[model samples]
Target: MITTTMSASERFELSSYRIPGSDSCFYIPEFITEGEEAYLIRKVAPGFRPALGPSIYERLQIRDSPVQRWKQLANRRLQLWGGELTSNNVLVAQPMPSFVETYPDIINRLQQTGVFHGSPHGKPNHIIMSLVPSTDPSQTRADDSPGTKFVPCLLCVVDIFLTVEVCVCVRVRSMSQAKTVPPRSSSTPSMSNRQLQPHEDGPAYHPAVATISLNSHCVFHYYRYTLPESHGGRSIDPTPVLSLLLEPRSVVISTDSLYSNRLHSYVPPFQARLGMPDQRARRIHEIKEDRFTAGGAADFVSPIANWERVTDAATREVLANGGALTRGTRYSLTCRDVGKVAQLKSFVKR
Candidate 1:
């Protein structure tokens, strides 16, 4: 049986499980119950069908398209709700799906935590659903799209099976002003115009990111951004500043410096060198490769930045094991409050 002794207010406090050596970040294990996680997985998963397609080849092809609504990416698929943002990072005024708006337990706790207190909208008005299939470590790619600039998002993961290593760029400013094109239809929108570029100043949204992990455990890595001397004479630190273990039903909150200063991405599956000398040597070898340098290292053995904060013994054991983890089908629902919103009527006339 699940049980907790802390008060609701205390549970959301930043001091409870904040990570060290970082401007602002926190972790909470078992933030949601098993029942809620199961419900969310059911909603995200494709439903079973009794009949097969006309022919064997057709059936195989049909199976490839797990969900019709997903916008296919090279490594993953995505679905957006409440319409895509405009060129100026503006969102059209529309109601989010009931499932998103009314995700009771999490929404209530987030509201209490004041994660979105200063945003233009009091709560999250946008949601991005990412469907990542099991991918080989060598085949996995980085998501450097402009959509990542939408900061202060709440990421909820369901059905995760492997450790996801994320690399983030902090303290670097983006100069690009790529436009955000809205989908053709709001409700059943297509991914035709989903490209996003970095913002000149920063994201038009707030600066807090909250993540909830469900059904799996993963390691979160944080890195500081640096520029090549040839570009502007500025140098970036290649080593990860912090790493945290995210267990099933856990929540992680990052804001301020952690949000604005760093770019975070999941680490691909690769075996780590157990000792520091061997690990550093391996990293140096990998860094020589253009792809590894451009993206970041996929494996490392440095101590997790927030290791002591994790209370789950199982997660600690996994981290202690220190090796390549098996991959699994994962679904992430990222919620954000778009600062700019226009009336639907005005959008239609345009």
Candidate 2:
């Protein structure tokens, strides 16, 4: 198990993980132990079997008994440990699967770090386990659901055989770059760029999201949205403002403007270009290598956001040398505390 001796004061001193040039984003390497990561993979992998059936009963029979419930999507498979949210965006009151609720390393550490101290439930009550195939074109999109209000998300990524790359984009909100709206009441001040409107469906967007990576490393790119006279609307800036090298077992947290305004997506494996002038040729050349090695010359083609704070010397060396990472199947578990919860009927009798 992963152990830490840091006191509360030390744990809350998260300034080291903060990514510069953005409002409030943080990254930590190796948030979980190797053993814990392996166990999580085992627990979620069985649901990926092709034994899915058209009927619910038929699907349940694939495994005599399963701990979690599965929902297959067009390009990926999802296992929702807690009950699904209601039409009004409330999570039905239900216990999470034991495997999910009992993970003390991740749960406790997050609490100690004070990431979810202000959330409605004071902890994550919903877990969405996503199994993304290597060839899937659609990546996880930005979530603005009512369930995401006032909660910090903890996303854990586990890859099988080191073959997948996950990318995250953070949008930064600024006063000069944003359009403002007058407040409805005198007591309320004018809203700045990207601030949630009163009529907006969901609660205001939370600023923090924490992601832990396991089994493999990938690149994270950040972009700013731009409006052009030619297009008559806003579009993603072709070139990323910054890029970061996410080493295996690392964790990244984005807050404030980075979480509310930025758009994040994972770049497809073996794609030739990433639209940045300095990275275009480097990315193409790196993907061309027949066997993807975690460390090689192609990895350091761009400036990593928090290079000085990395604890692992080898990871630092790999990035300095520009290493390469191969693609593989990856599983991401995103935990959130839905703002609304209703005592609805239970799906499982337990």
Highest-scoring model, TM-score:
1
Off by more than 4 A, model 2 = 1-10, 46-68, 134-205, 228-233, 272-302, 309-315, 346-350
* Winning candidate number (lDDT): 1
Worst 10 residues of 2 by lDDT: 191-200
Instruction: Give the TM-score of each candidate.
Output: 0.65, 0.58
Instruction: Encode model 1's per-residue lDDT on 1-350: one tens digit a residue.
Output: 12342223454555656666665887766666667766665555533111211111111111222222446674456666666677787776665555544553355566566777887776666666665443333222212223323121123122223332222222121324423323334443122112121111259667776766654555556666676576576444556566565555677777787788875554423322222112232354445423222134543564555555556655446445544444344456565667888877997798
Q: What is the lDDT of candidate 1?
A: 0.50
RMSD to true structure for each model, in Å: 14.5, 17.9
Error of 2 at 323 (Å): 4.7
Model 2: residue 257 alpha-carbon error in angstroms: 1.4
Q: Give a tens-digit lDDT track for model 2, residues 16-63.
A: 556776657776666666677666655555333222211111122112
